[model samples]
Target: MSNNDFEKVIITIKVRGSNEEYDFEVDSKVTVEELLFKFNEFLSIHKSSVKENQRYIVMVETKHDFIDPTLTIEEAGLWEGSILILTPV
Candidate 1:
């Protein structure tokens, strides 16, 4: 693959309220916003639907710092093996 080819990495996420581990495919160029969107989609389909007025939280590498949902995943500096915790309200 060329350097310009999009590289995909797998991120592991543990969603609140469930014991199942979620694995997500993310492109290297994806932004934080795209990550959240992908996460939300994963929740809605593989896990549960995002409730109204519920706040979704994303934490990287078990760090307390939270990434804004509006930002793209790529902007969040997500890499391979990045752990994202999804807390649903």
Candidate 2:
């Protein structure tokens, strides 16, 4: 794997309208689909209230734009300290 594949970025993820925030060190090359999967995994481990069927959309907090799940983190324009929001879709 290339260095980019293993590169990590710190991002803040939060559920919409909730003050609770999660900090994750994610592989910079991760696709949005993978990121959502990771988010779900995190929720399952930390916040059990999230149901299996609960769908989420990831958005760049500052830009307020939904990220394309087909794209990798670098392709999605994510960087260190970027803030993301996971809202129910």
Candidate 3:
């Protein structure tokens, strides 16, 4: 593993049909997909809730388009304070 430190970042979790806001610390090495897994664990959503092919998308900000959570922060070019909006498709 590279010694590059994954700068700490705050990720806000917003589940569909839920008005809850959960925050988590993530390293640049983490992927959005992994974050979803953590979110699933936190919300206690069954695996069946996570659909195939229609995976959730994480928006980096107001713009910048959407990105797959499966991609690491370095690959997705994410930075600290970058708001990751998790929305289910």
Index of the highest-TM-score prediction: 2
Ordered by lDDT, highest first, the candidates read 2, 1, 3
lDDT at 72 for candidate 3? 85
TM-score of each: 0.67, 0.85, 0.66
lDDT of each: 0.70, 0.84, 0.69
Candidate 1 per-residue C-alpha lDDT over 2-45 given as tens digits, one digit per residue, 9 for 90 to 100: 86888888888876677877788877777765766666665667
lDDT of 2 by residue, 1-89 (tens): 76545788987888897999888888888887887788888778878788875687889999999888899888999999988888887
Candidate 1 wrong stretches, greater than 4 Å: 1-4, 47-55
Candidate 3 C-alpha lDDT tens digits along 45-65: 544655544456677655658
- Which is the better candidate, 2 or 3, if ranked by TM-score? 2
The number of the candidate with the highest lDDT is 2
Question: Which prediction has more favorable TM-score, 1 or 2?
Answer: 2
